[model samples]
Target: MTDRDRRNLLERRQRAAAEFVAWSDHHAQEQRHHEVLLAQLETHPDQLDGRNAMAQQRAWAQRDQHRRHLHDSALAQLRHAFR
Candidate 1:
């Protein structure tokens, strides 16, 4: 590969890696927050706030899945380019 092509591939890989890490971090944070909310829902004595947490959990899960798909696709593309 030409130097320019190699450099572009490297840059794309780095960007993809960085984006994956960021999305992962956000997902983790969101999961943790959901856990805390769920825990509170279980532990608290307030019957009024007995809202279902599954909806939020499912939303975050879907978001994470989408992010993972994008990250995987990017890495796969980079790998193909490098080969």
Candidate 2:
């Protein structure tokens, strides 16, 4: 490859790496949030009334689903870039 082509490839790789890192950080944060939510549920079970508790549970489930999807997408992108 020519120098320019190599440089462009490097830039693309760098951008991909940065994106993966950012996604990973966000995923970690989400996981931490999930843990905190679980802890809160454990410690203050009475704090949420029946409907609110159900709502909180649903929201946590959605967050977990989204976190998993984002994690998988980021992994796929990183793998593609490496390959």
Full-model lDDT for every candidate: 0.67, 0.85
4-71 per-residue lDDT for model 1 (tens digits): 98898788778767766775787687678667866765676655543545555566577668757766
Model 2 residue 18 lDDT?
100
Question: What lDDT tens digits, residue by residue, belong to model 2 across residues 1-83?
Answer: 99998888898799898998899789889989999989877676587477777777898999999998998888888788766
For residue 4, model 2's alpha carbon misses the true position, in angstroms, by 2.6
- Taking all chains together, each candidate's TM-score versus the true structure is 0.57, 0.79
What is the Cα-based TM-score of model 1? Answer: 0.57
Candidate 2 residue runs with Cα over 4 Å from true position: 45-48
RMSD of each: 4.2, 2.1
Any idea what lDDT model 1 has? Answer: 0.67
